[model samples]
Target: MKFNFDQRIERRKTKSIKWSSEVLKNMFGEEDLLPLWVADMDFLSPPPVREAMMQEVEHGIFGYSIRSEGYYQSVAKWMEKRFDWKIQKDWIIFMPGVVSAVYYVLQGLLEPGDGVIIQEPVYYPFKSAILDTRCRVINNQLIEHDGRYEMDFEDLEEKAGDPRTKLLVLCSPHNPVGRVWSRDELNKVAQICTKNNVVILSDEIHHDLVYKPHRHHVLANLKEEYRENIITATAPSKTFNLAGMMSAHVICENSEMREKLRKVLDKNHIGMQTPLSMAAVEAAYREGEEWLEELLDYLQGNVHLIRETVKRDLPKAKFSPPQATYLAWIDFRDYGIDGKVLEEKMVKEGKIALDGGTWFGEGGDGFLRVNFACPRETVKEALERIAGVLNKEELK
Candidate 1:
């Protein structure tokens, strides 16, 4: 089936957080700004998923539901088919979302005041989850050299060795600045965490969205020893544009660790799934591959457009096509504008809303994260707006 990724769908007044006028005003201080900040895509979901959901709607009796054998099989098969990682049905556990899974894991495994290591310029919510659980955040910041990002393994080892540090939250194919970790990097990280007896919460939510010539390794699937120490969070949300469905999975191979996390979920009454979400997730995994392949091709085109536009129009800016994910992290430091002021100019003068680099924590200043998972026309307009704001003489 040929997917029309270029078609522009109307999202306004659809209760979309990304397109809501009120949300834009509150978030960017401009009600009419062109929004390209949020991670959700502007394209419609796959036809099979929509049809499955419609079947559920036609049934007309929405009630409490339990996942069936087919549901688990779909998830297990996806892992095997996509990554060559064979996973058992029993290893999967349901969660409403990855962020909620992070909270639950912290609550279940670590006590208050314990240290959790996270790479900086990472997803902002990782910090929030740690602080919300009363756990201390230990920053093992990423190293940037020549417009590319790499892990600070020496720093990671030092932090993981701390007695107070009990967990490490890893953003695989990391958000904000996307670089898919190679097998060697994953092995080194696993060795350090396992040696120090620290649990690794490997957030592989963006695993499926990686581009060609770059592969995302499932930390647990790399080695048996790593499996015992890793808890992976995944979802069809990013892959299938199903974020509103609120369905995600937490895979734990170790029985004891699984029990601990399950206890936390059980205590909070968090295991139920919505009938609609179940249909959507199952259909996505079982029959959405054709749609996904075409979507990736479309997204890669957008990536190239951004790269070319930046080089041609904004010569002072620094950007590279991300190895994975739809988010593009571009540095505007050469413009000599403060990060806050640059973000303000984007919203007020350029009439665009993008994620400020500072929001991702340390090492993020003087940068902006642009989400390009929209129509090509939308991306072109956003690039023009960005160039208009940054290329102005007054700002420089």
Candidate 2:
């Protein structure tokens, strides 16, 4: 065991959103609720990442720093060695975070009122980012057939064909629903968007966390034409638990698209890359691979624990094991309750906080997204609280 998955760390009152009293009160309306909603892991990052940050702190001078070829090489090599995607140094553009990157992409690619397509029950920020820019959100809701999610290509094609629709924000290894899009599925998306002249923005933030046998193919790397039409946002945040470091980067092969994005970044004056963040990112990709492999093993165990508990305790709930990421998409529609009612019960009655399925927009009702990236005990505790409430509610 390279790392201890059961190690518990106290985060309450640390200004951690997942554990903050004020944030919990605001989000779940309970100051003392146990939060399992945020997408970050409760585990410590890799030792190398910690050592790099410590070394930087020992120097005692946090000054402005510029990214060097080594930083770019770390990213390029990681992508090549891990995902088989050979990208160049020039293709990388550092951003504060993936959510910020989405804001910039919309600002660059679309004018006001232009339509952007996103699959429903996706990561909520995609919709938030689009609307924040005054862009119209066009929904291509995913279809769940027999507990597996598939893209609605017929609907996607129709949406893409609309001239008003200029961008499709794709969540590969999708969130909340957790189905890693297959190669053929991605090919269909590429073809449809290309045929309809819609540019594709693939958020591969969860790219490295895919579970076994479910591979993630960088959409831009699939074809030369696809490369020209795609802009990908990726980070070690989700992969290495570095979200707090505020470091993410975009990969765009199209020179013009890159230029447009750069213009938006420049307009916002957003390039403030910290020295510690740069160190952490490079160390994570260069030295954190082994830790990540072990972390995946731990996450799978957490997934299994939740699945079994749901089956035994909350018998009516439908839990389709996630193919990737630590998030689980659980369907509780059989309880015949709206997502809000289910979410409130989990928060107020169960005393556990989870992301409501309705927050993911249409088709997300009657589901909840559980982040099982914490220790096994935490997963069990949250499920037990949820089980008591759900079981009692079922008897009503």
TM-score of each: 0.98, 0.99
* CA lDDT, candidate 2, residue 337: 84
Candidate 1: segments with Cα more than 4 A from true spot = 394-396
- What TM-score does prediction 2 earn? 0.99
lDDT of 2 by residue, 190-248 (tens): 99999888999999999999999889999988877677989999999999999999999
Backbone-clash count (model 2): 0
Q: Please, what is the whole-model Cα lDDT of each candidate in the order they appear?
A: 0.93, 0.91
lDDT of 2 at 233: 95
Model 2 RMSD in angstroms: 0.8
Candidate 1 RMSD computed on C-alpha atoms after optimal superposition onto the true structure = 1.0
lDDT (0-100) at residue 190 of candidate 2?
98
